[model samples]
Each structure stands twice: as structure tokens, then as C-alpha cells.
Target: MDMSERELHETFLPPFKATVDEGVASFMTAFNDLNGVPCTGNQYLFKEILRDRWGFGGMVVTDYTAIMEMVAHGFAKDLKHAAELAIDAGIDMDMISEAFVTHLKELVEEGDVSEEQIDVAVSRILEMKFLLGLFDDPFRYFDAERQQEVVMNPEHLKTAREAAQRSIVLLKNEGNVLPLDKNTSKRVALIGPFVKERESLNGEWAIKGDRNKSVTLLEGLEEKYDGSRVEFTYAQGTTLPLIDRSTQKVSVTEVPDRRGFAEAVNVARNSDVIMVAMGENYHWSGEAASRTDITLPGNQRELLKELKKTGKPIVLVLFNGRPLDLSWEEENVDAIVEAWYPGMMSGHAVADILSGDYNPSAKLVMTFPRNVGQIPIFYNMKNTGRPFDAEHPADYRSSYIDSPNTPLFPFGYGLSYTTFEYANAKISSDKFQSGSSLTASVEVTNTGDLDGEEVVQLYLRDRVGSVVRPVKELKGFEKIHLKAGETKTVEFSIDEEMLKMYNIDMEWVAEPGEFDLWIATSSADESNHLEFSLVE
Candidate 1:
């Protein structure tokens, strides 16, 4: 949330620069202080960087109550002082704070803030309104007729279902227990608190969504099969507690009732295949919702243990916003589906993936640690001076004594219904000039029986630079689909810009050195690699 000037410019600022390049209409200042200064009142960030360097002509808005919080942050004398600092620093609008409305005029009159600065801020806000056509017709986006026609229409629902299906990430599939035979006459048991939760399906951000219209996993399963052929039973194995975000506390009344645990076990025993929909409810993982423990909550894991004793195939379907500590589930569960709050068509998408109507293709964008102890672990992390040496364990190099120093799932990690094999990578040239481009290519073959899409990732490491660099960084990626036994070569073009880094002098330049490039499935899977050199 916060970083030094160099780290901010080198890492966090790139995406913001890209957004400005695309002509985004507005930008919001962060709530946290960047370095030492509060982001809402940072002159360096607003004036020197965003406005002057990036040439962002858009309006800069403060996050909710950020201006007022500046006083709480001890940076401002009071609400009036906060408003003056924010305006002079380039914030155009105060969101929910009303600091500007209460204090800006007085500040200008007192000669503490220039009237010209106020005019500039007001001009940006008016320009955005003009661009949005709100000046001509304030009700342009508030049409009831348009809302009735477009909202939750058939086309929109189809797109939502398709998008939900694509968003799913299949975490584990032991012996290919998933894609169960829909035609077979089998008892399919769907168990958990999340199975029929329509209101929690959209998660926290969907404040205006119609919860009644959203389909649940139970509803989707029923629609997928004929009632006569397939038997579906649902049991609320555990309940989730309602959390108070501000206080980080739960009510005694909201504590889960484990009375349904025995019923869930009984249902699992009678079923041929079990799908346990387990995870944090809508309240457990979003904004302001921090957890000291990242494991399955309440009696959810105990419920799974009871279901597993039935000696039937069990698939765990998770629905949480953040990465969970699935070390136990990873060992016991036959298969796992990460159906992260799949919105309006949550049920349909889960049914599709479970029934094999759609092959799972989405990759995990963030790294999943083995436990909370590895909280800050990431793929692009730099190798420290005494990095963990597996071969020489007694050397006392950097490592965890209790657990292995590796993530449960590395960044860019995902699985498809079909398997893909990566061959040795090759490059167009051994050496390229600073201004020239080099091509890296690798052959990927669909080795499994099913056709599927794979996201081929390209990563590289500068062997040596003026300053230490990350072990590897993702440069480019492409998603491609192939039939079974088909082989296709994926290529990525690399130039000096792609390899450039902020050196000791903080100048973005590609130093003359060898680069080790890998073209493979994920950051951890670096078996297929090639080397190249950059010339002056």
C-alpha cells in the first residue's frame, strides 16, 4: 500500500502510467501515505509525478473521506487545513469528505490557497462532466427504460455465465475425478453453506445487484441433469459467522451451528460423488476484512473430514476473494475448484466446470502460499545473498526450518482439463543490440485426451546488472487453444525496453549482460529455458 520514491516509480507507477496513456477520465488518490506523505495531499505524487511527468489531464479525486482523514493522519492541522493541502496538491473532488465544500472558499479568501488553483481544480471537474454528457442531460445514464432492457437481459446473462466459467481456476484434480459422468445414474451430493447462497454469490462490491436473480450452485446442478436419472442432495454442513469489519469481531449469535454436521456426513455416505462447496462467506475476505487465520472456517474442514471418511470421491469448490491456506485440503481433496464469487451465473459456471461442459483454462494471477507464515512470498522475489540451498541444507542459508521455502501455488500457475507439455525453448539470435528485438519461441503440445486452452508465459532474468534484480519477471504471455496431440510454437518478442531496469543511478537502462529466458506454464516451472546476450 506504501513504498519509497524509487520503488514507487519503478514498480507501482507503470500501471498508472499506462492508464493515463489510455486517456482515463479520472484518477483516485490512495488512502495510505506513500513514503511519509499522505497520498491525498502529496505534492510530489499529484504535481511532480502524475500531472507534470505523466501529463495526466484528467481529474484527481480523493478516496472516500481521505481529505478528512489527513487530519487524523497528523499531517493536517484540521479539516480546513486538509482541504487546502488537497486542492493545492491537485485533488479535484473530495469524495464523501465535504472538506472542500466547507473549507476551500475560506482558504482562498484568507490567501492561504490561490484562487487560480481552485479554478484549475473546478475546470477539471467541469471538463469531466462535459465529457460524460452530464451537462447536456444529467439523466442520460439514469433512464429506467434502458435499465429494464439491458440489465440482466438474456445476452447479458449468457456473457456473465461465460465470463464466470472462464474466471474459475481448477486448483487440484487427483486421478481426474472431476468432469463427472452426467449421463450415469449416480447420487451427487452438494454440501456446504455456499451451495445455495444467492445473496453471497456476488460478494461485497455488488451492492446494487439483485440477489434473488442470481443462481446458486444447487440450482445449476438441478438444471444440468434429469431428476429421474441423477439424484442431488444438499446439506448445510456448516454456517459462517457475520463479521463486523470495523471492529474485526463476530457476534456470539452468528457462531456456526454444527448440528447439521451429522446430516451432511449421512448424505455424503449415500452419494457416489460428493462436491463440498466450502469457503469464506461474502463478509470474510473483501475490503477491511482481515483474517489472522486463513484456513477453512468454522466446522467446514471438520465437515470435509467427515465426508472423506465415506471413502467416496470428494471435490472441494472454494468461493473466497483471497488465497486460502489449503495445505490440508490439497492433500485430502480429490479435486478443487476456485469459484471465486462467480456473480450472477455462479451456479451455471460451477455446473459447467464440474460436468465438463467447459474446460478450465484460467490461471492463478497471485501466488498461493503454503501457510500464512509465507505471507510475503512471490514469484519475482530477488534471491538474497544467502538464499535457501536445498542441496546444502546444513549451511544455514535462508530457509524455513518448519516448512519448505516454496509456495503452494506459484504465480501464473493454473491447470486445464487437458495437459500440456513444453519443449526446449529457442531464440532467434544469441546477441542483439540495445535498440533491436529478439524472438523467443517454444513448442507446446496438448498431451491429454481433451482439447484445452493454455496461457503460455515468458519470463526472464538479467544475469547481472548495475543493481540486483528479481530472480525472474513476467515479460509477455499469450493464451492459445490446441486439439489433443497437436503441437504449436508460441513466440514472444523482447526488446531493450522489456529488459530495462532502474539501475544504481535510477535510470531505466538495459545493462550489457546475459539474460536467461524461460518459456513455460508458470514461474515455478522453469525447466524449459534458453540464454541470450544484450550488446551495447
Candidate 2:
């Protein structure tokens, strides 16, 4: 599960790893109401899960619409009882369910709930209210408080800006026309309908965000230096595809026209460099979005080829959520930047990188395969009887014919403004006892024009096992900073359990055998392996 607030509480770890209090906490039978209603009106969910396992002593908020939905869950006598049971159960806030704000204290005085409990809940809520500055000033966050000033703060801009550049996947850089020297080209063409819109800029589930004020790529370029000298033209290559029927009760903005694609190609005809923006909209791939095909939308695939026909240096900025099928763009475009909805003002973030205000260091979080056929492929998984081998053909092995066994872009792949070299790997002890520790060390050097950082990864592979282990497991990793020509040694200490494998019965065990320890820059990169033996 992701590191969300809710997940930080509900999802329990396997019992073998549970803490002392967690071990003591046991699941109980589903209970009905104290008399005739459901136990949701009961005070246990908050008293235990909140106060005990989670240590969430602050306050408990009813899930949205929960107090109102209590009549349906059949826990309360009415909205009144639902509100009463909730507050008595230590629920502190009513989030849109509205009833708790209406019927809490009356039930408390009726002796249904102890006044102390009400005070506890009220004190908790009021404390947060005070911390929010709601009680002290009530209007502090809104009144001349610089909401946009902070939202679009220089630091946030820098992060979004740096992230956009790093997440860019340089699929093909044929001529090296990139790192575009402003002196080299006076005129450039920024083409694409998405050059302005941000429906997909921050992707889906972006909380409390808007696009009307988002700085578009064109706007970013114009805002940068010498806007008067840099001759630039823009065209709508093609409109983002639509479903033909309005879904929003208040209709959303209309998509532009696709016929503009040919005109966009014409605009790029004589420019020194061409920057083409391509990809899906905000509603395209987050949350409920499940695409049957993850490819560039509309005629943009064909549009890329036409841009190539112009013979100008081309840089493609691709915006998408999941791994896209980019074989065509990878083949034709000079460079492809995979900008995954880089948040508000994502366009300005792009301009920051293109202008070389920041360096790229974002590694890919998921594998970008050549196509959709290789779906659900990830780095951390179990080893199969016969892992998919492309060189040596196999019938029963897990593989596909039309596609290669490997991802087009493997995991932990990212490029920086500089380069790094890895060497001199060593383990504290070539021999590690079952209960002892093993230290893996590697020296890394940054050999480039500018200072940069690299996330050196350490992986372990169990050669022969009672239960098969994956080809590699990321046992440890470290992010190190290095000067342009400096080197540093990184070491990872491995305890017995970190090197252990789970058996068929899910028992943690480490059998005496040859284990290969790897220290590499990335998962697919060549790693110097040292053989270590774990004794019984």
C-alpha cells in the first residue's frame, strides 16, 4: 500500500512482524447493536483500533457521510442515535455527515454518554481547531495569508520543475541537438494542443487544484529570458480525444479540433528546433481510468513522423500516467521526456529544465514496456520454474512471441545532467553466520561536467534454495552526493533476516549456500557480484 494517511493505520502487517500491542489485539465477532441496532453505534472501533494499534489519540473523524449512512448500516435508532453513538464511541469530527454537529450534547446529558467522554472528544477537536489557527484567529489561513504565494512558492516550483525534468525518459537523442544552446537556435516551434491545458498536468486525485492559472509550456518559455529574441510559433497538433457525451453535470470545457494537426506540422516546418507536446488528459489514466491500449492518442503518432519530415531538431514532451506504448516515438523523435503529470504549473516546470535551470534525476517508478502485452510486470516478484528467456527459446516458460521477455525500459532508470561510475565493491565478511550481519560496500564516482547524485542499489540473489528466490532482491540502497570528479564508498549492513528467504510454508530461513551479492547503479545495469556463503 502507498504511504497514505489511511493506509498508515488500517492495513495490518503479518502477525510475525506485529508489535507488542498489535500481538495482543485480537479480532472479535461482528456485533449487533447494544439492544436491537448494529454495533457501529457501539464504541469499540475507535476505542481499540484508534487508541490502541494506531495510537491515534488526537481525534477520530467519521468517514464522509458515515453518520448519515448509519440509518442504512442499521446501527442507530435514527440520525439522532447515530450521532450520539458516534460521539460516545470517541468520533470527534463530523465530515459532511452533519448529524454529529446537530445531536451530540443533548444525548450526553440524558446519561447515554459520560460528560467526561464528551469533554475528551470536544477537547481533542478544539485542540486541533486551535492548532489549525481556527480558534486563535479563525481566518488566519485565508486573510492576506498568501495561499497562492505558498502554493506556487519557489520551493514547490523548484521541486515540480526538477521532478518534471528527471522523470523525462530520453528514448532517442540521435543528433545531440539537445541541451539546446540558446545561441545555436534563434527560432523554435512549440506545437501541440496540450501546450496550454492541465487536465492531465497534475494527473488524477490532485487535491484542491485548478488549471486556469497553470503556466503552460508556451507561457513558461515566454516568461524565461530574451522572450523578445526567441522567435517561437505554436499550433494545435491535434485535440485530445473525447467520449462524445458530457459526463459532468456542469459541462466541462470543450476539447479543441484535430484538423489543426496538419497546421501544427506546417508551423514547425522552418523552425531551428521543434518541441512537440503529446499525451492524455487529466481524466485519461488516474483512479477509475483503465485504458485498453496505452498508446499516444489520436494522430500524434503520425504527427511525430510529419514533424521529422521538417528535418528540424525535435524534442518530444510526453505527458502520461502509466507506461505508454511509445515504439513509434522512440524510433522517430530525437528525445522523449516522460512527464507524468508533474503537478500544478507543470508546463513551467518543463521550461525550467529545457532552459537548464535544473538537472534531471527522477528515476522511473514503473516499468515502461514496448507494449501493453507485458502488463502487470514489476521488479519485485517471485521466480518462476523457467523465467522468460529471449535468447534461448522455450515453450512452457512464461513469455510472449510478439514481444521480448524484458521491459523496453527496466525499473530504476533515470538520467541526470551528469554521469556516475561504480567500482570497488566489498563485503565485511565473505562468510556470514545465520544470526550475524553482512556488510556490502561499493565506491561510486561522478565523472561529469557538473556535480550530481546517484542512488546506488544493493541487491541479493540466492543461487540455490529449498524454495526458489527471485533473480534479485533489493536488499539495500543508498543515495550519495558527489562532486564533479569525486568518489565515495557506500556500504550496506545486512542482518540475518534481510538475507533470509521465505520457504514454501512461509517460514523465514537461510540455508547454507552460495549467495551472490550485487552493488549496481540500477536494476538492469551490470553489477559486480561477490560470492558469499551463509553457514548453518
Candidate 3:
């Protein structure tokens, strides 16, 4: 990506800076190149920004075969040159690449590389090993009995369940169709490809996890509601495409004999409510899983259309790794819950949300686009010269003729079983002076009958600057619990640090200008805001 220096520091580098601030122990270099330089061999990134400017003392490691891949990136002539470049760029470890092991010795002997550089890299690795107590006791982490005891202990599972519950985002709930009433909605139909799926529950990264231990959605629901009280029906509406990775060319094909659309519809027709689990299979995402179309894979969309014929309230429960194109589901489905691969406790956590045992408090960290056409969509985007106006449609403006410029769901957006209202937003001062801080506060009240947690978000916009700025940037957020009919005040401290950004000259500074601040629910929220100015 050809990122400008301003964009690199302001947008892309903040997260890495944050990790460095938090004192992360290690960092793995990216496989891709920035501009024309591969990250594994980019001196500007590893040496200048990460080490010199930020003072990140952590060991830097290359991604799997990333050091050797510099040849493919055309940044290096061969493995020896790639190894030399990576080491010179401050890479302390080479993952899955023997380039460093094989070529470093020869390069040093040939005077192409210095012995001191090798010593520095080895010292960093040894420092990390010492910190991990590997030198003190190399076999400390190899206790099989301890590993077996704590691998899936009850306490760990409980924490996993809670984490899974909090990670669930309630995207859309038309007419409050969610929190399925067990007493009223007796016959519940659990339909779709993932009804009893176990292998995909832990997602792509959980290679060591035992799939058999995972509790399926059907199993969780059955355990939550007794069979005597709430009758349950199950149907595999469709089967996911089988991915064969035995050869160099991966083949994805549908199970020839497992289509059960008719049976699923028949079951849905008899049930009062339908909980359809649909999304990409675990393998459809993660490494080497790039796709042009990020919609519900397989015949699942067709299956949903068939189930809609029953006229039952469909609660679409998503299980996937990345943001999906949920344009049709958002419009057609009664309710939508983004339960992104909730690990081993996926089923129990999802069931808790569905049964109203837990109110979802998790907000989306990433923006979900309405369609794949809006691939690079985000909340903190710079308002171009001809910004799109919803009130006044113009062909010259930056927008799509077919769809709105807005996303399906904005960043920091999540719904709750209970409703929240933001009121009385205020700033401690009208003008902020250098070295002094201001408090931005707002009153959040739980208006609904159920008690819930609300993530009060704080966003800021620099109206004018030497360089163009984002329309809004999230500065602070606080997740507070409010009881039914309770109101709580949430305050955020805003200092010059929060306002600092790379100027036109690429120097980090806070320019004196008019700024807009909002203490609201989500990035899309524009209801309550305060205008302030930074003075010289």
C-alpha cells in the first residue's frame, strides 16, 4: 500500500504505537511490502519508527518465511541478500526461514555483514528467552499433567463463555424479535449448516483445540431450556462446501447429497421462531483465504430465502472470522447477531444471548460494509472535497449511484436488549490551552426495562488544520453498566496528546483550531456535541 507519511502516522501507525506503549514483548513483521519495500526488510519501519522514535525494546521476528519472501517482493536478489537485509532492518528472529541460519555466517565472513549486528540480534533473542524463564528452567512449560489439568478447566471455560458472550454484537433487531421467549415460543427450529457444527466452533487458529469438546448450538439451547417446557426442532438446511487442501490447488465443492432445503422449510413452518446459523466455514477466512465475495457462502442464502416462506421470525446468528456483506440479511431477517467464532464456548454464549440470560454489550471494532463494493470503507475517513450529501444528491459528489455512502453498521455500533439515551453533553471549558486538560462528559440513562451495559464513546474532529483530518476519530470510550431507569455520568479527559497529529510538514503537533467533540454511543452518533477551540 502506497501510504503517505501523514496517513501512515495518523491512521496506520497509532495501533502499533499503542502496542509499543503497552510494552509488548515481541512483534512479527508483515509479509507484504509498504510502498516498494518489504516489511521484513524495511529499515524505515523497524529501525526508525519502531525502535528509534517509539523505543520498542521488544524482539522483532519475521512472519513465516517472510525473510526469504523478500526475493518474491523483488526487494532482494536472493536468500543471502534477504537475510542480510532483514538482519540490518533489526529482525532478531527468523520464523520458518533458515535464511538467517544458513547465510548469516557466510555473509559475516565475506564482510558483507558485521559480527556486531549478529550479536545484537542474538542478544535480543536471549533477553526474551531469559525474561520467559526458559534459561532458568527450559522444561517448566512442558508438564503434561499441568497442561491437561488447565487446558479446559471449569474456570477457564467459564471465562471463555463470558468472553464469547461479550464479543457478540446485536446488529439488527427488527420489532425486538430477539431474546427468544422460551415460554411463549415453544417450538423453536434450529436450522442451517452450522446447527450441530463442532469442527468450526474454535475457528481457524484453534488448531490444538479438541473439536469433540465443543458444545454445539443445538446442545447449548437444549441444555438452557428443558425439552418439556420448550420443544426444539433441528434441521440442516444446507451443508457447507467441503474444502480439499491435499494438493497445491485447493478445491471447494458442495456435498453432492446433503441438500435439505425442503426438510428445513417444513420444520421452520411448524416452529414459532427460526434460529438460522449461517456464515463462512472456519477455513473460509484467516491465512490464504482471500475472497472477492464475502457473502454467506454455499446455498445458505437460498436456504434462508426458502425458510422465509414460512413467515417465521428468523434470528440470523452469524459465525465467521471477518466482516461480511449482510445487505439482504439486514433487510429481510428479523434479527441479526454477529457471533464471530466464539471459541469452545460458542454455543453456550450464543444461547445465553438468545435466551436473554445475558444482554449483549459488545460493540463492533470493525465497520461492516453493506456490500463488497465498499471494501475500504471505515468510520474515520477524511471528508474529500466533494463529500456526499444525503439531503442533496449530486453526481459530482463522492458516492455510489446504486447505494448510500454509509456502511451496513458503523464502528462502535451494537444494540442491547435495553435502550440507552444520551443527554446533557458538556465540556469543562470552551477553550483548551496547551499543557491543560478538559473533561467531556455526558449522561447515559437506561430507558428500557432491562438493565444493560453501554459503551459510551468519545469522538473528536479537528475542523481545520494544516493537513486534512478525519471527519471524526475515536479518542476515548468507557463501558459502563446501568440498571433499569438509572442514569450515570461518563467523563473523558482530553489533553493536547489526544489532539496531536502529523502536520503538513509531517511533524506531530496540536494546531490551534476549532474542534468538535461528541460523547455519544457510537461513531455514527451525531446527536449531542460540543464545539471548543484550542488556543495558542
Best lDDT goes to which candidate?
3
Candidate 1 ranges with C-alpha deviation above 4 Å: 244-248
Cα lDDT tens digits, model 3, 1-536, are: 89888888888999999888888999999998898999999999999999999998879999899998999888999999999999999999999889999999999999988999999889999999899999999998998999989998999999999999999999988988878767764778989878799889899888888988998888888888865367889988787765667742225453523358888999999988899998877888788887888888777888888888889999999999999999989989999999999989888999999989899999999999999999899999999899998998887999998888999999999999999999999899999788888998999999999989999999999999998899999999999999999999999999999999988888889999899998877899999899999998
Give candidate 3 regions above 4 Å deviation.
246-252, 255-258
Residue 486 in candidate 1, Cα distance off native in Å: 2.1
What TM-score should be assigned to candidate 2?
0.75
The clash count for each model shown is 0, 4, 0
The per-model lDDT (C-alpha) reads 0.89, 0.70, 0.90
The TM-scores of all predictions, comma-separated, are 0.97, 0.75, 0.97
Error of 1 at 36 (Å): 1.8
RMSD of each: 1.4, 6.7, 1.5
Looking at model 3, residue 269 earns an lDDT score of 94
